[model samples]
Target: MALPAPPKANRRAWPALLTLTDDLLEDIFLRVPTPTDLARACVACATFRRIITDRSFLRRFRAVHPPPLLGFVPCWRPGFLPAQPPYPSAPLGLAVADAADFSYSFVREGKWKNSPWIPCDVRQGRVLLKCCRNHGNLLTSPSDVELVVCDPIFRRFVELPPIPDDLVDNRRFDLGHLLAPTAGGEDEVETSFKVICTAANHTTLVAVVYSSVTGHWCTAASRSWTSLSTAVPLPCPGGSSIFDYSQGYFFWMSIWRSSSLMFDPIRMEFSIVQNVPKHSPKFPVVAVGTEGIPEMFILSDDSFHLLHFDIAKGNEPSINEWQLRGTIPLPRNCMFYTTLGAAEGFLFLHAIPSLKDPPDYCLLDTKTCELKKVCGNHQKRFNRVNAFFGFPRSLVK
Candidate 1:
């Protein structure tokens, strides 16, 4: 019968990835190496998008592969420096820089049209900014300002309710930090977030937290600076006073005082960690150590010193102690500038080789001890640049 039509090819013999079950697909996706690849995989089809966008899947993916550092957003400027050539996440970072609104045009709606919004913090693909007059004094107590949290990728924002009058009175807002939803044990993404704004009076240091879930501002913690240490003067608000969030606590370091203020969001308490090496550089950055403890990286004259802080226990009462873990010598001809920030085990440093040469933005891998330049000779100067370290995702609730 016509040679049996040459025996029709069997479609079943070919691989059918689309036919895979949801569980099997998620298992396969978990093995995806980076969030950039994961984001690309999301566009393959509707099925892939559905599975990847699920909150449960995202939580699992983050646990396995932490989000990548996409770029650096200048604190005062309106642009960003994306990860460029040779980096594994270069493509994704470039895509974000091209598509996202770093200028934050969306906040210009209504009464905020002319108000300038300064980025206070960036975490989990969201930017936390404060909207106020150009002449506003951020260090003053009980000021009139609006806090806006936005996802530039999705071009969406929520104006956080103002801090309660009682909480704001006599308090100077000094620092702000953004906390992810999972940080509070919630699985949902983008539907909610928490903002911690720290303020201080001459006598008391106070933290006021605004929760999107509840739509209210509440004082999370407050402690007298004198109680922590009389020698440590009130942390003067400045660009050099850096803060990092690690192990569910917010640590604020005062470079001049050689002390750090630690805030526990859950317990609503503040503790003091004293005796940071006085001789280290002014812009030392903090990151989580391999053992889950907080560590500090100090860029000295010729080497980068790693110090691990731990609670020393005995009959002498518990105290925070810093131990020298290791050091990495700086490459020849390179000189320390200032630390930009730290994220995902990498400390971002801005270094100048010579007084005549252009500066470079470099990344130092805390675990592997690998150092490389990510961006070179950025044209626009910035007093502070915060590392934005997460991939854009669906904002659907």
Candidate 2:
């Protein structure tokens, strides 16, 4: 009798078939994507409902993926940071504003080149930054002559003290960031981290961290601030950028043209990550994320194909076991805007192209595999989606 057809009833068997109780079974099912799945599992019985909502099960969701290689993707806009006169007496950095304000600039196509106030050279524009959790507020950096902290979202920013005139003139370049405490509350939002690289002096270094608690930039007994030179350029968003905090250290990159320097906050060192090995004759890319892991890639068929990587582990020198992973290919003549917060299971993409009927945007997806677009509409593009931004906190908890 064909071995009794291998027990046909086992497909839907609930209690007896599996060792787990109805409650436990539903808990496993909660991890499923849709609410419909949760609803169905709940209806399986009261036992199912109890397990599905169990706080413990949800907590596991906090880490949706293997601890992500934390990284930052610049919140890219269409045009460029507004630049000033052909007559400005001093050198300037990039445009800085809250995320909301940046979006308005982002929405206005060609404004980058079109805006007269915006510098003709985008590389000299302000480097903007947003909170990993709070994506609306922007951290602004205009130029070495003056520093302003304005919340484009609330229209309120604290004016930062300008660097000394002598210092500004002496320094060839500058970089900055707004950093919050590693272990703190949702409300802690004041301290700022700034760095000015004196390229003219052949010295690369960080400036200072102005602490709201003490109302001054934290200074060491040596009467100087800390330095974060990871041999990698601690990219100040807007260019080839990647700045993340992992293993109690700040990881970043500062890209020149074909090369970059990796900076790790803990070691306070700068290391050259030569694209010669990671890049191709085609396109070159690199990133530092989730505990300062370095991921190098190349463009092939409009996608950034990962070549190899090693995340922030402990000492003994972390290494990226280089290997081709996947790619995020552009649909048209577009490119990735930025990559931010590797949370649950996906990586976020801030992408746009001049030719897009509407415009490109930051779309979240995954690092290991290509993802289908969540909402394809410009109106709803920024809303955080599931499979992107790694895994959802809701699912984890």
Candidate 3:
């Protein structure tokens, strides 16, 4: 079965696979399935890396291809507790799941992983976890806290400098609100974002600003929490909050007070939003609404649009209020829960089944009306579900 061997010159002659135009290379790279794949491809060869890492190439890639769903981080309750040594504490770490199948991977390889840091808020793709460093006493004054901003998908984290001594010892103030990725474009993972800290005293809302671009933490300005009275839900800054990035505002919920705090990052101003009506409907209020109906934020026509839906016994799911839009019919038996929240065009219902059965975290697409079960039997572990929403994978600095 032996055959004549080919010439050595012929065997050595092979064309390079990367000998293509930049446009062609970009087209190939854009087709990569996920961000992880893109990252891996960038490391394969110098030419490929250079082409993929170019600013224009990355921008075009994002425009042509949709962002990936990085995963969900289970933000545990009893957040930002005082430091106690002997008592048992809940493990503070994110339960990261895959976008496609909702599979999970570890953050920082799950090292020690016993810290008490809990997530305050997740914006753009960044999770802000904070914990008190040292507490002389919890009754009289607050403790010095450290905030760690992390990109769970990237597994990169940075700890901001400690709070100033005077701010820590002040009896009237508390780090009630924290928001991250303070700067840079929303599409890019830039390290230039700012961490805006809102401290609530008796009557005034003091803001402490942290600039990653300048590497400095200074008190930006102060404003009065003057217009409204405190509500029964105990309106802490980021405790029950949602960010409207299009409007550059963060709406903080006041459960019984019937008002929400509207914070502006650019102007550093605080205004009262009175349109959030008092509703004892069978459902829970999720996010801000448009034209007097509760709805989620939507981006369209170079401006922000509101997407609202009604879940009732028999009526088809339709957005009728505020210059009526199209209707999306839901599948049968899908409107079981009366309370829900919407993010990224999906509805997350508040369901806690009977003790004999496990709880369910169900997601329904507002556009498609397709229902899927996510995070099966997670209720047995944590006390309460703090943050659950769709987190699209982006380059959040």
Candidate 4:
């Protein structure tokens, strides 16, 4: 029996793998932070690549891992419509920057080859771009606008169906996207997304939804928009929409009413989140999360202050009271600024320089209260801040 103890290789194999079970291997693979890193790991061996590419494994990875701060997409465009043939062509492109370390790059793809695409909203790691090619003259003819949902990280896009004739002719529509998790544990990067176009159909609000599951568009009927007029008097024509990931609500800020238009994608219902904390009229911005999804900070009194819209506590049906959390100060005289975006307890603020100083971008950590300069004149010239947040990484072919 002792002489048949077996080869040395066989004895070491069992002990070596005792601590590295299938579950442990999957956990180690999920901890890879970026998609680029994940891709690199796949090349190590065929077995690892197969596990990473598995549909179930991808779902579990995304569920367990929190998104990391990638960079900001700065858009530079004069208007939503392309200039006439005789006019000079406009400059439109997306600038990608490492807001943490100040590294930067630009995404120049065929989608924006000729005309600039207006970035309307960012959510679920995708940006909604409105193609400005067919939009007719603002005064004379109806605009034939087309919407596109883009994954800037992957440099890919999916064009949505054209808007209805009436909705385009009337010129009253807003776009938003929801990248929900699929029930079947499909690849997150390939499928499981919905685009909603809210248009003012005469006196009512009609939403056209496009689902990746069906590969087609459908209309959602709701009476919630009937009373939306009281909260948002005029629909935001080609404006940005923000979604609350944890609470599952889309928010549209109403400049006229100084309130927020909240839409529940599940119920197809609309409600108003009113009593937002007053902010600077010059550069009003809302950073949706400080510690989590419930706490939000708005730039007020030339500083970033925390507030919460407690929807569950209020007795009123329409408005929820905003509770103050804390205040975050800025560099002296750096008052005029806009909040580009937020994620993982960080706020991206774009400071507008006065005549004496230069423009700057900064990253603020809400937890540690540390402020760091991400970009300045040395990195790149940014005219506008389109999106600044954590971009998710997924393996989708």
Judging by TM-score against the true structure, name the best candidate. Answer: 1
lDDT of 2: 0.35
Each prediction's whole-model lDDT (CA): 0.70, 0.35, 0.48, 0.53
Q: Say which prediction, candidate 1 or candidate 4, comes out ahead on TM-score.
A: 1
- Candidate 3 whole-model C-alpha lDDT, 0 to 1: 0.48
TM-score for candidate 1, residues paired by index: 0.83
Task: Please give, for residues 148-234, the per-residue lDDT of candidate 4 as tens digits.
Answer: 666655656776776556444454544344443333345334555777765543455556677865777666644444565453354
* Decoy 3 TM-score against native: 0.60
Write the number of the candidate with greater TM-score, choosing between 2 and 3. Answer: 3
Per-residue lDDT over 7-105 for candidate 3, one digit per residue giving the tens place of the 0 to 100 score: 667467577677688889899998887666898999999999999998768767765654433223444332211112121111111223322211112
- Clash pairs of candidate 3? 98-103, 181-193, 182-193, 182-194, 183-193, 183-194, 189-395, 190-397, 283-338, 284-339
**Residue 238 shift from truth in candidate 1, angstroms:** 6.0
Go through the candidates in order and give the clash count of each: 0, 67, 10, 0
Each candidate structure's TM-score, on Cα atoms with residue i matched to residue i, is: 0.83, 0.45, 0.60, 0.69
lDDT of 2 by residue, 1-397 (tens): 5565564565764565557875567446746664445667678877777776655554343323232211122233322222122312101212221222533333222223423111100110122222122121232222222323332333333434543443334433334342322222244331332332221113434334434344444321111122322332332332123333333433332244444444444344434333334344543434443334555545454566665555443443334344565555656546434343332333445455544544233333334354433222343243211111111121001
lDDT of 1 by residue, 277-360 (tens): 765646677776667666887877778788887632211113456678988776766755667777667777777887677778
